[model samples]
Target chain A: MVRYKAVIAYDGTHFNGFQKQPNGRTVQQEVEKTLQKMNNGEPVTIFGSGRTDAGVHALGQVIHFDYPQERPLERMRFALDTQTPEDIAVSSVEIAADDFHARYHVVEKTYHFKVQIEKPRSPFRRFYASYFPYPLDLNLIRQALPDLLGTHDFTSFCATGGAIEDKVRTIYQADLVVNEAGTELTFIFRGNGFLYKMIRILVGTLLKIGNGRIPADSIPEILAAKDRNLAGPTAHPEGLYLAEVKYK
Target chain B: MVRYKAVIAYDGTHFNGFQKQPNGRTVQQEVEKTLQKMNNGEPVTIFGSGRTDAGVHALGQVIHFDYPQERPLERMRFALDTQTPEDIAVSSVEIAADDFHARYHVVEKTYHFKVQIEKPRSPFRRFYASYFPYPLDLNLIRQALPDLLGTHDFTSFCATGGAIEDKVRTIYQADLVVNEAGTELTFIFRGNGFLYKMIRILVGTLLKIGNGRIPADSIPEILAAKDRNLAGPTAHPEGLYLAEVKYK
Candidate 1:
């Protein structure tokens, strides 16, 4: 069997997310189906780095698959293109070790959340960004980032169905950057792993800080609470994207 | 009456171009409806620099409108946030002289046509850009630009439309720029006025030049032929955008 690793990019608007589903269309199923057709009607299984919720997007998603062929890599790329839609693309492909499972080999991941504060809508940036009419306090959100760093319990920042065995995760970085244009705000996070709805909840709490509903230093207290109810509402999934993944 | 000149921007994916239509939802109709609502049911006509075809986008489309009430321009900019959809926006508003006309007093107009040349789908950019799977010869397309400059009969380039009294138009600048990343190709055209489908025809013939199907010098001969049948196919409308309209 020939093992291949591919870097993918997708607009998640039409997808139910990355994972395979029974009824709804998914990025994984579409790729696997395309592979099956290329292999003359043989179903194939492909492994992805992680699961992105519905409506989320990805710029550098990594994946791995095994196929019983000794063909050149270029032909495989062209074959996949012939089978997939215009919204999903295989940005890169290469030969990989047999043990290179996309999920197990991941070392680092990054996520970005965007908020457009201006009243006028941006014509070119509508799909990839989220619009918020209310004004936000940037200073307060920036102050909370330092406390959220380091290994700590993030239970308060998780939504429902967060059944991870460990709630403690190390956040290498969490920073709030006011866009140079001054009309947008971006929250960037780098971590070992993320819990269910953790990033969205973190964004919601920061928004509250911007709204003056929650104190900037209250993040530590919320983490100590270990109660999801104490955190603010979850932000929308559209503005979130899997920017990159790193492996050792 | 307060004369306001606004620089508008819109993602034309959901809009039927820049003009008002009796049947379909148009960018002009939507903006007009919003303005009427804000003016307490007052009817106002907006004059755009030019009419963009259906499915075409715009970044710096200049327009002018009249209102009897004297209010801060910022209020009108903010009011559109609640009145219009996320795809359209009034980027800026300013006071202009009574004699200033968006269409009649134009100095220069810049239009850009964007084409995506990658194999995989770019989901986020699917609606805003045109996708072409085949590779293009950029140098050959560039070689054909010199013949397109200066005044010439443009009957072969334009579509059959309302009485075209003047068939000669001067093209101050015409060039095809390949993005630094080598991922996108944009064709920019600057002139006083354009006939129906002129840009699309120019693109079609240039594409033929790139494919070696026609020589670069064929453009002047095609102009001399004064027959539309000698030209290549007209390009799709989705790839075109009215980038800017300048007036001094």
Candidate 2:
């Protein structure tokens, strides 16, 4: 058997989430179903780098699976790409060491959250971005961003359902970029790891700061509090994206 | 009663079409439903610049409707914008003269057909673009575009289901624009008016020429024959967009 690693991208609008469950259609189930077809009726299980919540899109989610036979990388990629639903795409396929794991690897990740700041939101962007029509002060958000950099225990930002005990993670980058038309804001975050819903909460808190609902200098206090209630409400899942994953 | 003119945009993936029909949800039905709520439950009829087929999108579709009261234009625009589904947006509302008709006063219309040439189509663009993974020579398409400009009986390109008797239309522009990535081709056409499925058929024929399935120089012959069968197959509706409607 050969272990294959693949990069995937999905729209996430129609999917329940990246994980497989009996109740709803998911990215894992879809990919595994397609792989099973190619495996001559044998079941093929695939492991994703991590689970993305429902309605959260991904540009470069990683996965790994073992196949009974070896195939050309391009052919394998093409087969998976054409067979899966149009909302899911297999971008690349490569051979991986037997010991390699999609999950449990030492890595870094990058995420992006998009917000449409224009009034009366755009029809075309409704699914891909979160719409915010209120007045926002970018300078205030910028002032609070530095407080989020470096190592921090993100218990205040993490959702309650995750079983992770260690809340400390290193944030290498946190920045906001506005499009040329000034109608869209994109939040970028690169970190060694992220807790469940952590990025969404960070974005929500930053947006609150931008809109004057939260103080610009309150991030440090919020982090020190180690309480989920101290953070802002979680941003909508539609705007969050798993952009990249790096393994060492 | 006052006539209100509105510029509308919609993502047509979930819509039946732009016109009101007995079956399926349409953009007109949604807008009319909202207008009815605003008009004390009285039905308000709207006249559109033209009908767009099911699954075809629009960026600047024009419509005019008579209302019982005259409200601020921005307020009217906002009311309709927020009330409609997330896929539909009312961009602007204006007071129209009593004699100004949405369909009759139109001067020109711009339509765009987008084709994705890249292999393993991007999931994010599946709904917004038509994927064609084939070798296409853009120079051949460019060479044949001029034959489609100026005035001509476009019966060869019009689908047969329409009841319109006149098939002659003046084509003001026929251009193929390739984005910087060279992965997408946008076929833009501005004309006095278009018969049912005319723009889609034209794009289909142009893409055939680009791919060498049809001779690049046969456009004039197709126009002279005035036979729909002579034209290439009609392009997919998802790629077609009614981009703009102009009034004199």
Candidate 3:
């Protein structure tokens, strides 16, 4: 059997989530079903780098699966692309090392959170961005972003339900970019790892800080406190995106 | 009674069209339904600038309706904005002259058609753009656009469903803009009026000329011939947007 690694992109609006479940439609289930059809009705299991919650989109989500027979990479990609739903696309496919694991690879990930600050929210962007009607000070959020740039225990930023005990992770970058129209704000984060809903929590806290609800300089104390209740509410999932997954 | 003119926008992915019919959900139905509720359950009807086909989006579609009461414009806008589905938004509302008509007083209109030329189309754009995998020469399309300018009979570009006999229309502007990445093209057309599916047919003919299936200089002949069979097939509606409507 040959192991194949593929990069995929999906619009997650209608999907339940990335993980497979019996209740609702999911990206994994759709992809696996397509793969199984390609494998002549034999069950095919695929592993993703991580699970993205419902309504959260992905630009370069990575996955790996083993196939019983060898085929040209382009042919496989074409088959997968044509067979899967239009909302899910296989961007690239390549042979991977037999031991390569999509989930276990040691590397980094990048996420983007988009906020629409325009009043009377745009209909075209309603499903893709979170609307924030409150006034925001970008400088305040900029000043507070540095506190999250280094390795720290992110217990306060994690949502409950994750089974992982260690909440410490290294954040390589945290930055905000505004579009030319000044209507949308994109918060980009790159890290070695992220706790469940960590990015959403961080964005929520940062926006609160920008709006003066939370003090701009209180990130350090919040992290030191290591309590989930200390952080701001989780931001809406529609605006969150898994942008890139780098495996080394 | 007061005449209210409003500019609305919609995603149109789930909408049947801008016009109300017996079957399928439409933007007009949603807006009228919301307005009726606000008008004490009295049936309210909205007159749109024009009808857009299924899957065609809008950015600045204009509509006018008569209301029994005069409420604050902001309050009316807010009520309509909040009550309509998330896919539709009331951008602006104002009191208009008693004689002002949404469909009759239009001086100009602008429509935008988006085409994605990237291979293995991006999933995120599946609902908003038309994917063309063939090779296209933009210069060819640019050269042919001038033939479509000035006044001309556009019967060849008009779909057969409409009963309008006067197909002569003035083209103010016809331009093609490529995104910075060169992966997408936006075709903008400003004209006094358009017939049924005119923009889609024009885009289809333009793309055919760009791809060398038809001669780039044949636009004049097609317009003069006034034969629908001479033009290319109508393009997909998803890429078409009713961008703006103007009033004198």
Candidate 4:
């Protein structure tokens, strides 16, 4: 058997998420189904770098699978792309080193949150952005961004009552890009792993700061408190996008 | 009575378009319903710049409505925004001069068409854009663009059996912007009016030219033929957006 790595992108609007579900359809199921159909219904399992919840999207998601037979990378890539649904595509395929594991070899990941604070909704960017009619203070959000970078115990940001006991993670960068079109907040985290709903919670906290509900400099205190209630509400999943995944 | 002009925007995915239908739900109907609810069930007829077809979105659509009593623009704007569904919003409201007509006073209209030619469907942009698998040659489309500009007969690009009899109109600009993200082609036409499906048909003709199925220079001949069959199929409405309306 040969191990192959595939770079993929998917629209999560019509999907239940990245993983396969017992009842509802999913991105992984769709990709696996396409591969199965190509191999005459031969069952194959794919491993992903991480799982995204429902309504979440991805631009550069990485995954790997084992095939009983060997084929050229270009042919496999084309076949997978042709067989996949319009919402999902296998962008690239390559033969992986025998021990390459999609999840275990991960070094970092980046996610983006798009917010449209205009009075009138954006016709073209409606689906891609979260609209907030309430006036947002961009300066406050920017002021609080630096507190999120670097290593920290992120227990305050994780969802309440998760199985995760260890919440330490390193954040390489937290960048905020505000333009006339909209506000795009990007987070680049280089960590061993992340807790459940961690990124969403972090976004919620920052949005609260923008909304003036929380003080701009209260992020460090909230983190130090290590209480989920100290953070802001969990943001909508539609605005969050898995932008990239890095592996060593 | 006090009259106010509103700049509106909506995502046409869940709406039936700009006009209010007898029984069907439309963006106009929804806004009107919200207005009536705000006014204790008092009905008000709202007039828009033009009728946008079902599934066609708008960014800068202008509308005018009359209120029985004096109302603050900020209050109405905020109330309408709060009451309207997430898909629609009233961006701005200004007390217009009594002579302001949403349709009659329009000097120019700008429309944008987005085609996602890249691999990877963006979940966030799925509802706002159309995906095309085949690669498009934008250079050829650009070469054919100049021929369509200026005042001339455009019967070949207008939908057959429409209400308009005059097909002659001036097209100020037909700009094509292609990048790594996707193809964003915008047409800024300065005309008195447009025929039904004229823009869609023009896009289809340009797409055909881009695909090499039609010669880039044959645009003038197609226009002079004054035949609907001379043009290609109408581009899908999902990719179309009314970007703005310029009023003098």
- Highest-lDDT candidate: 3
Q: Write the per-residue lDDT of candidate 3 for residues B1-248, one digit (tens) a residue.
A: 99999999999889999999999999999999999999999998999999999999999999999999999999999999999999998999999999999999999999999999986898878889888999999999999999999999999999887789999999999999999888899999999999999999999999999999999999999999999999998999999999999999
TM-score of chain B of 1: 0.94
Compute the lDDT of residue B105 as modeled in candidate 2.
97
Model 1 misses residue B44 by how many Å?
Answer: 4.6
- At residue B134, candidate 3 shows an lDDT of 96
Give Cα distance to truth, residue B1, candidate 3, Å.
Answer: 0.5
CA shift at A82, candidate 3, in angstroms? 1.0
Two-way TM-score contest, 1 vs 4, winner: 4
Task: Specify the highest-DockQ model's number.
Answer: 3
lDDT of 2 by residue, A1-248 (tens): 99999999999998999999988889999999999998888999999889999999999999999998899999999999999988999989999999899888848999999999986688888889987888899999999999999999999999998889999999999999999889999999999999999999999999999999999999999999999998899999999999998888
Fnat: each model in turn:
0.90, 0.88, 0.93, 0.50
lDDT of each: 0.84, 0.93, 0.95, 0.80
Q: Each model's TM-score, in the order given?
A: 0.84, 0.96, 0.99, 0.89
Superior by DockQ: candidate 2 or candidate 3: 3
Number of the candidate with higher TM-score, 3 or 4:
3
Distance from true location, Cα of B141 in model 2, Å: 2.2
List model 4's recovered fraction of native interface contacts, to 2 decimals: 0.50
Cα lDDT tens digits for candidate 3, A138-169:
99999999999999999999998889999999
The window of 10 residues in a row where model 3 chain A has the poorest summed lDDT is A119-128
User: DockQ for model 3?
Assistant: 0.85
Residue lDDT tens for model 1, B93-164:
889999899999998888888777765656666777677666567788888898989999998887876587
Which ranking of candidates, highest lDDT first? 3, 2, 1, 4
Q: What is the TM-score of chain B alone in each candidate?
A: 0.94, 0.98, 0.99, 0.93
